[model samples]
Target: MSAATVSSSPKITEKMARESPAEQAQVLVKSRICNPNFIFSIFSNPPDSNYSKLKYIISSSLTEACNNSVLLLGPRGCGKVAILELVLEDLLEEYPDMISVIKLNGLLHCDHNCALKEISRQLCQEHQLLFSKMASFDDNAQFMVSMLRECGLAHKTIIFVLDEFDLFAQGKQLFLYSLLDAMQSVTSQAVVIGISCRLDADQLLEKRVRSRFSHRKLLFLPPSREDTERLLEHILLLPTNSSFPHEYVTAFNVKLLKIFADYKFKEIVDTLSYSDSTVNHLQRFLFSTVSHMDLKSGLLSLENFKAALSTIQRQPKLEVLKDCSILELYILVCMKRLEAKEQELRNFNAIMKEYKSIHDTFQTSNYYARNVCLRAFEHLLQRELISFEDNRGHGQSAEFRPVKLLISRPELYQGLKSYPSCPVSSF
Candidate 1:
């Protein structure tokens, strides 16, 4: 028998497929670490729809391993990846002897043949299969498919996971089609879960690939504003170092904790809300929040989250973005939506067109006066946030280029989540 595959986290583990019960238990001991950074530990009872789905999926995966083929769809930073990690961990524990897993990222193997060969390589290496040393790509892939099927028929399980799944759709869905197609004839079952960040990824799938699982999917929508607050609140209230032996402690600082305790829900949302940020990304950002602040008897202030956000995205100083005002953010949003290239000199007329279109769409009559807009544009130039071909003059209507876009469109969208209630929303 084979064993577990590659791992992203130390907690989601695999034991030798045919190892003794004692040996398998030993392999899983690593999961007992008490550090809160282990995301699989923090995944306990999240306040969202994923809990039920995870319960069902974990149960079904243990019961019917091979036949599970899930397509997880969501945007960046969402907890889509974490959800899968939990599922894999559960399956590993439930079917130590029967299950063996391999996870690969779509971005790593954009080519279909490369993707297959890589998957085959990982499986072979872990299982000590003869295909590990095989030279021919076609021969190795076929052997892998056969071995996976044979395992299923033998009442053993094989799980294949592809992250960044959209990238793997390149080769006519060759890798996906081959792996999934083989699962049908096998008796026990095998699973192939593909995860993608693209919203339109399903539409890009070829009919054959789509037909592999008859169009099965798991959509991971962005968290609602209320859910975002709950998530942050949960993180804020997570056990600190002295909070006792919680399996996973939330990363909190004394300074930050005090503010969270005192801030109203609306007040918290006004400060900490980030657009397009998922639990995964937020968790990562949260991990670094303590490092950004001073740790003293004084509790952390809400103002510190601004530094964390700026640091997370490698953006310019938060003050640079703060100086630009909401209308400035709207201008950045317009430019980004229009796909303004960094290399090209953007024309003022083009930007105004986008701004006009945005106002018409959102039905807002709150555009800044042309003079105010031009001054804002000139101010951006003075701050070195943007550039113009004629660097000598404040030519508002001329073509200009963004030199230091402190906040990107996606980040701006995130910032806009608390808009209108925003500091400069009044103007």
Candidate 2:
């Protein structure tokens, strides 16, 4: 086949197609996962009932401190993006003629300069008539100032919602300071709504910027297990005729939801789908006469679970392993490592070294090994089971240190105990 034709072909195998309905349902559900957006759309809108609490707070701010900024700080996946979308919808209704909402996700632009440039570019493109005279300027900061001037002259209010504000706070202190200063100097009535994973006390905004936002309300949202369960139910209710069994869903709630509650709703859905695939694969390995009930409990048993681990370890190539849902394996492996060390936190280097030793003994590189390890780390981080600290200075390699490990998987940890450690600490 031509390269183009080969690339266009479906990658999943025929065997995967014949998997259990539950497994297929998991995959179908996750395949429809949506990337969080800032726009106010029908699919993205929050339930009206959830808005009452937030509306009062925002309305109070708009009435009392029209010029000051509001900062919403919370843990990741605590509905910051949803709240912003809801607020945007509210702004449209409450201040239709007077205000315009501009939303931006900071993570999309990795660099400070690039972020500001894009923001300016977007504003100019969005309000071409108002900014046509100043469009020739190459300086983004200057362009932003001019745009603010125009907004002040024409609109009663302009609100800028900076989502993922923590990304910018990490190394873009100067950029934030300058933006705040420029906003403060604007003749037009303007305010900012900043959303971040860290609270204001934990953030490093400059004194001036901090003071500017002082009068504005600061709301902190912490993730709750209840919210996660509710979110799962919401997702399961999406498909018109989803065949995901209630028993399977209940198992997910008990075994996975609590452990992974800190993850974004989408992340949790992806992990569950991967786990379902793992369960399906295990079932296929069993004899045809074995009841599905026996297979289910067998896969959950310590001995059979270890056997599955062995199967993963014996995989000759990473490519094959990756295609078979290595994320589930990685999670199991990480849990096992934590149990073996009896440590609350597993250093990144230690985990990588252990994996290298295992690979060496097998005389092969598992294609998904490195990526699986990283995904596991990300999962722990998302769950707040681990806190990763990257000590590398700017433009240097990042070193990861896991601060904690939540769930314990003893079988996986025992498997790693047999492997020798690698020399490099990069992992």
Candidate 3:
């Protein structure tokens, strides 16, 4: 395929570059192991502002061997988890024997008991300590505290990293508060890092819980266009062989079709920071291009890339909807209905009323207070499932422009009808 076929190019999304194991290790750039730019895709400037801050925090915390809490905040697909992994790498090297790092994702351990049990399980697995599973929350809580305290008294550094941190913010504050308290204790040289997609997740904390995490906070901004472009280039370049040229043409049916984006595929690269659809589609194109690369020529020609592209079947992305809460699903139902009616710039109050109407219609016992509805609205906004325009107005007259549905509204609602509490069950 040539450039004409993919004129509107899209960026390489997180799923494309970072997650897919085949692409993660092999498909990306042939850059050397030591190149800092290529080391982290979409991270253009080595030691940029956020990097420097995070590096400094890691260095300071390591050198001091004292308790420190850091909260990393960023939007989805923005690389908060990556930064934490980098920090963990440093820890692995710097204090192999003296430190124990436990990484937990809030998504999987949303329940208070689950989180506690996970901690105990991991500790035992790591050290081969055979302890009976604490059956009760109190027992588990005490078990976790005792283990941490023992580690601290032994002059060992304990690090707990919780990603998707906002989930933990909603339930009982005990786990969070306890972690922070362990960190600050005079005997425990522990560190707690909470990575959240919410910019103001700290607000969800009780005053006491909030106080522990107030020490350090860093927000990772989305990567820029240039950074993204370079990231793709770095990831694409192969030292041994070229899969395809930056631009290529393919023969589709009887005509020559250009399967390219961004003119030079820049269009595809530019959207990396914002669009997941673009990423999903582009990943297929790249994979196809690479697979069709000629072995003897050691390069992928337009013919090879196109032949591969022609065979790829596009798949629907409905997993996002499957992961929505009941409240969030109802909110999506409301936004979708409003969008179907061509209603634009409706404020929160208007959406809330619509949501209630839909909720009541469902004949379910799900109860969402106004605050809960608002929370779901904000969460939906963050996920980019629903988007609204700010009319630059606030208070009584604030007009929130049309709530646009990025995902297939009909499909999402169908998923809801089939399984409303799919994601909530995990919590």
Candidate 4:
């Protein structure tokens, strides 16, 4: 049996190796499209050209061993962090020996004591110093200051990346004060780069803390429709100068361009633009598109895009209904029937009455007791599929409380269409 299995493995390997050149090219194309770094590399900077400004200012500051501070402000998923990271990554590669990076997030180290301890830990790890947890905040702060002074003497540039900077600006802001104060007091070549979603993050700082800050702020905004279109082209269009075979690249690009021109594809892109016009959103959308590709097709299509877009834009209520029990769906259907009759005050009792009428009239099998139906009704209420009127804490029992269907008529119809054995017609 072992010998037979060994022999059969080669057959499997041979079958896998039989994939065509086009299929292999498609695999590479999918990989490139899904690669966040590759996608970010193709990022079209805004008209203000923040990417260049970041690269130039940070690079020049590092080169001169000068201390500088900058804040990056933007809404979440607006590529503020991505742009900064790309610039920092390139700079680190260029000056590997000269640069040492320390990353801190306000979510994790917003407290002054925690920030100090984290600074000590990161500093010790980066410099290969034996780290001992300090017994007090003062000891930790002192150790960090000494470490910064030592780093300066060694001609090393420390780059501090503070994410969610607004959180760190709360309370006494001892973390910000000590950090900015260190930049002024010590001779260390350091760059304080703060990234925050809050546009007014700078204004949150105390006067003492704000005084120490360099006051340079960069604002990031969502990509425009034209920018989003350009991004799509860069992501989906195969580069002519790529290492891929000319025929494969040309063929893929042709197909991609045709897809781009298609109104359906354009509409999908437009819909996404109106929802979340971010690089991250576009990548997520493409991730779904690539997920639908297979060796047989070996190419992306409008159908794949449509399916992916539909998945992303699916209704939450419909999705919830799909996961519901048949009994629960029955309760929903009862509510729907009651709604169709334009019944006022469709409370749990009223809905249960409608359910029994249908059950008796149709003589439906697999009968659920009133208690089971009540439990299902309560579940629907929990999911907010049904909501109670402002009659809570009244003398009436929970069953008599007036409720309304949260879902629309069309949603009920669509949700039931895909549900197996829904028995929607029994109503």
What is candidate 1's local distance difference test score?
A: 0.59
**Per-model C-alpha lDDT, please?**
0.59, 0.49, 0.60, 0.77
Better of 2 and 4 by lDDT: 4
Candidate 2: residue pairs that collide: 152-188, 318-366, 318-367, 336-413
Each model's TM-score, in the order given? 0.63, 0.46, 0.57, 0.70
Give a tens-digit lDDT track for model 3, residues 39-128.
343342356556567756766665676777788997665566765666566557666877787878888987877888888788888778
- Candidate topping lDDT: 4
Give the range of the ten consecutive residues with the poorest summed lDDT in model 4: 1-10
Estimate, for each residue in 347-367, the C-alpha lDDT of model 2 and write its tens digit.
666666655555566654443
Per-residue lDDT of 363 in model 4: 84
Candidate 4 local distance difference test against the native: 0.77
Where does candidate 3 stray beyond 4 Å? Answer: 1-45, 240-264, 271-274, 277-285, 292-297, 300-427
Tell me the TM-score of model 2. 0.46
CA deviation > 4 Å runs, candidate 1: 1-48, 61-66, 132-134, 238-258, 261-269, 274-276, 292-426
**Sequence-dependent TM-score of model 1:** 0.63
Question: Mind giving the per-residue lDDT tens digits that candidate 1 earns over 178-263?
Answer: 77777767464677777888877777878887887645677777667666655555444433333222332223334345665665
